[model samples]
Target: MSLDSATVRRIAALARIRVEDDELPRVQAEINGILGWIEQLQAVNTEGVEPMSGGSPVGQAQARLRPDAVTDGDRAEQVLANAPDRMGAWFGVPKVVE
Candidate 1:
């Protein structure tokens, strides 16, 4: 799928990018190179490969889960100490609704 200069200009306009007339050829060539790599990737065969869902290997055990415990509680004064405008333990903001 080769891209012409007109198609490249149209793509730039659609993406809200301002590409100069002289830069169109370079941009078009770069896009064509990316498309060529995608074409090469598509040509490879992977009939029964399982898709990876996370960084860990497929057969490895998952990471140990941390115990759910509250380490900090009842520190309202400390939490609200740096507020320019606060209302009863909460930061206050200007209302914008009508």
Candidate 2:
């Protein structure tokens, strides 16, 4: 599907983007280019292709996990003690905004 001027404006509004009146044409062209590329990708045949995680193909190699070890041992109190305001072992900060 091709991106039109109105659709581009609606997309920008939904994304909370503020595009100048003069820049709307450029934004529309960019969105159209992206949509055209996506449409081209949809035309490809992937009947037998398996979805892959990461750069490697599916079932190509197995991943390894590190052995369980003692990394940090009971440092909660030591960490909490450094906070500016501690409330029974928790950091306290003022409300960020309304």
Candidate 3:
């Protein structure tokens, strides 16, 4: 498909790109070049090629995560001790609403 001056102007307007009167031909030429390249790419024959995620044929298996183990980190008391204001085991803050 060939990109014409009108199509280029419409695309520029839609993309919010302001092309001056003199620059319209330049923009149109650039769009035609890009579309020409795309037309060349469309002629390639890829009959039985499976689409791979990372562009590589050898798909690497995802690494397994370690099973969740019940271990106590136990830093609650230490964190609470450094608070500016604490009531028993909870943080104390000034009332935000009247």
Candidate 4:
């Protein structure tokens, strides 16, 4: 979808980006170019392409996983010793929400 100047300004505001009045036109053109490239990508034929979940493809060499074991257990006392506020076996922080 092509974006207008007003739409580009709205996008910048939504993203909390401060775009100067003079830079609006340049930003608008750049965003429009990106959208055009996306449109071109959407026009490609990929009816039989399978969706990939990660960077590596399926049936490829997988990363070796280490055995799950607790290497730093029984250190709760030491960990909580320097805590400003301790709640039983956990560190306590001020409640931010009601």
Q: How do all models score by TM-score?
A: 0.60, 0.63, 0.58, 0.62
* CA error at residue 12 for candidate 4, angstroms: 0.8
Q: What is the lDDT of residue 18 in candidate 4?
A: 98
lDDT of 2 at 25: 95
> Candidate 3 on 1-98: residue-level lDDT in tens?
77778888899999999999899988888888888899898888878877677655657675589889987868779989899999887899999999
Instruction: State, as a TM-score between 0 and 1, how close model 1 is to the true structure.
Output: 0.60
Clashing residue pair totals per candidate (backbone < 3 A): 0, 0, 0, 0
Ranking under TM-score, best-scoring first? 2, 4, 1, 3
1-98, model 4: which lDDT tens digit per residue?
A: 87888999999999999999999999999999999999999999999887765777677788899999979688999999999999999999999999
Cα lDDT of model 1 by residue, 49-83, tens digit: 76665976587787899999988678889888998
Candidate closer to the true structure by lDDT (higher is better), 1 or 4: 4
Model 3 lDDT, full chain set:
0.85
Error of 3 at 89 (Å): 26
Tell me the whole-model lDDT of each prediction, alpha carbons only: 0.90, 0.88, 0.85, 0.92
Segments of candidate 1 deviating more than 4 angstroms: 57-61, 67-70, 73-98
Which portions of model 2 show Cα errors greater than 4 Å?
68-70, 73-98
The whole-model C-alpha lDDT of candidate 2 against the native structure comes to: 0.88
- Residue pairs in collision within model 4: none
Q: After superposition, how far is residue 57 of candidate 1 from its true place, in Å?
A: 4.6
